[model samples]
Target: MKTLLLSLKDVEQALSMEEVISAVEQGYISYNEGKVQQPDIVSMEMPENNGETDIKSCYNKLNESISVKIASGFYDNGKNNELPTMIGTILLFDGRNGAPLCIMDGSLITGIRTGAAGAISSKLLARKDSKVVAVFGAGGQARMQIYALCQVMNIQEIRVYSEYTEELPKYKEYVERNTKVKVIICDTPEQAMKDADIAISTTPSKKYLVDKSLVKPGTHIVAVGADMAGKNEWDPEIFKGAKIVNDSIAQCISRGETRNAIISGIIKESDIYAEIGELLLGNKPLRESDDEITIFDTTGMGIQDNVTAAQVYEIAKKKGLGKYFEFI
Candidate 1:
């Protein structure tokens, strides 16, 4: 009566950022090759928060589903110290037999995989000569975003902004010693975003933190926040001007930042240029000009979780890492 058990802390020790990116890429390839299945991202409305949205996606591509729940103003309620406000789980299933594979820590896996997704997207979509990177939201996810970008680009500066105020200065210190780039904590999100070669938003906000008017033409934006229906980071006008890239359009529309823009009539379905995999696989094209803005709206792909979890499972299984017990 024994089964393998893995904890969140255990998963953290088992995987690295580079490995997560590789696994996510596998899920991406599986998706493109018609080897995966992903259910549409479905939205659930919350009663008290008009702007609150919860979205879930089950990926056939990686036999995974990522459910992200967003609740804004929870910090405003003076309960900011409890469990993390943005909370959810990623379920991983065995691809070959559909057995429940491993349930690792979602938040940690999220930080790694989502950041890797941005890194991989930038690898395929960002300009080859890009230099500066700016990130919005100075939380843990924001830190990881900067970490991932550093893996793929030789960034000159990193501008960080957060409405949270207290986190920015600490974030600046964390990046300075860890990275070779110049780290600046901006007073406003707009100040961080403008004229940057690459931009990433990791906030869970209902309103747009990135205005279309502020973006420099040809800037590559990888937006990771606003996965829920009512939550969004980039303005709809931004969608109008840029060539949009997504992980999956169907999943993107229900829970991703792109979903908000489409829901509000800011962009059309036909506007999406292609999935990031398409570009990586050579099925689509990259930026043709230095003036056309490109946005990668990421809604945590399932394959990302599946591949990463699968890797963790193999390593943990071999190491005799987790306690085992029989489930049935």
Candidate 2:
């Protein structure tokens, strides 16, 4: 019995924001160097419940990330207090032997990794002295995005916004308590973005939550909500004024949120300055001036999951956190 396994708690305990950011940067660099392998996401639309729907993202990447997410949303808020409106798990495998390694909680991994991607983007794109951070959608990812920003930036105050009125106070209390950063729940996304150096979006709506006019001269925006096809968070003017950086051009065009901009005559695919890899590898510039606006469309690629999961697995194995079993 190759008796060592890892759980979600184990992975969470072993990983830090800085570590996650480093791994995400490495994943980006790997792509730029042509050393990483990725595939288009294959998914299925699950049947509905009380007129609500869910989706399953099935992915495989060199045995490191072989998992599916079953995510559903039900908005009968007044009725049963719908659970999270999202739920999923990960099934990690031994890439070398094609054997089971661990079945861990993917929620925190997904949340932290997503937030770390935002942090990395902000680090590369935003003004270094940025102090005011605006976050649209006061939800799970919003919490982490701001947390990472607080960890990395000089943010003295955080402004938050969400469409759901009921969740604002809860989000407000939680952020200020955990981050120890003064938090303000703004009434609108536009209000939140005003004079802010960085803005992050974490909603799944099919519309734009940010305004091009609200952002000042030098602002970095990390759009993480629209990771799928047909979802958008900004107009072309936002990308037009900023250096548009993508996680991956092909995926962004085919299914990511950037696809909408490309399709709507708002932006040309050629307008993209570079992928995150180019910056991570010193092949391209990230931030040039104090007045430049930068946009990062973070439709996550597979390599992120592969590398992060691999890191968690390695650390957990050394720490002896879980039990290994024979599942060949």
Candidate 3:
């Protein structure tokens, strides 16, 4: 048997947000149907070095494929080493016989599929006429989140907030060039969040950035930053009155935004409305009314990584984009 080795450029050329969203949605469906075997994420944190790594894996029974991903984030890498803050790799294997299939870059897959998770949440939870967007981050994930949302919703105006004020215009220009959505730079995070139909937070801030007071009723907040313990973005108080949907109830309670809320006594485990997978399976209802405030807390599921990487691997193979090596 031969294993394929794919590069970052190859993965990027083979995958798109639209296709990833579709693939990820199926992952959620399979998860809800009890067809995916996913374990708790393994986390390694180094506070002294300002770095962390997470190992995730899952077996998709429906597709008979498995993927294991290792992703790392070193916040000071850009300042100290001029490297990207996040890096990752994925290994794809055949579930039927445990044969190695592909080894590929996972950073691009992570960003795109994380964005796809947000898009899936918005499609099911956001109001039907949602047009204006408030995005709190100017990084790669932020761009991809907006890209995925635009694929599913009719986003017209976008308000972006970033600590790096100068990067906002360049990001704005990039978005305008790639998408028809108009982008505005906000002086404050509050300025970006006010009266917005949808808000996405993609930063890795230790402290809460979005205040509960700034969020209006009917707003759908996609909290994507709080994927690890001690990483949070939204105020826990927001959960007191909002309907909370997390990617995984267990994952969220331990490391997602819901963890902070639960720790602060603002909410409890029973307060959770349902997992996004449950909503996808029609086991729970979506936003009951346009006036309801809904929050989707995504911690990035292993099943998502497995299915998305599988899709990318297949596409790259069919396109003859990567190198193949025989080992067994």
| Candidate 2: segments with Cα more than 4 A from true spot | 1-7, 50-82
> Rank by TM-score, descending?
3, 2, 1
**Candidate 3 — what's its lDDT?**
0.92
lDDT (Cα, tens digit) per residue for candidate 2, span 1-328: 3534555567778688888888888878877877665656654443345323323332344334443433333444336775555454656655556565666556677788778888888888888888888887877888989887776777788888888877789888998898888888888777788778888888877777776678778888888887777667776567775788888887778766678777888789888888988888888877999998888888777667666767777778787776777655
TM-score of each: 0.87, 0.88, 0.97
- Identify the candidate with maximal TM-score: 3
lDDT of 3 by residue, 1-328 (tens): 9999999999998998888999999999899889999999999998898989999999999889989999998878877897888899999999999999999999999999999999999999999999889998898899989988999999999999998776698889989888888998999988898669999999889999988899988999999989988988999999998999999999999999999999999999999999988998899899999899999999999999998999998899889999999967
Q: Which of the two candidates, 2 or 3, achieves a greater TM-score against the reference?
A: 3
lDDT of 1 by residue, 175-234 (tens): 877776788889887789766899999887878887777888778999898776667888
lDDT of 1: 0.74
Q: What TM-score does candidate 1 reach?
A: 0.87
- lDDT pick, better of 2 and 3: 3
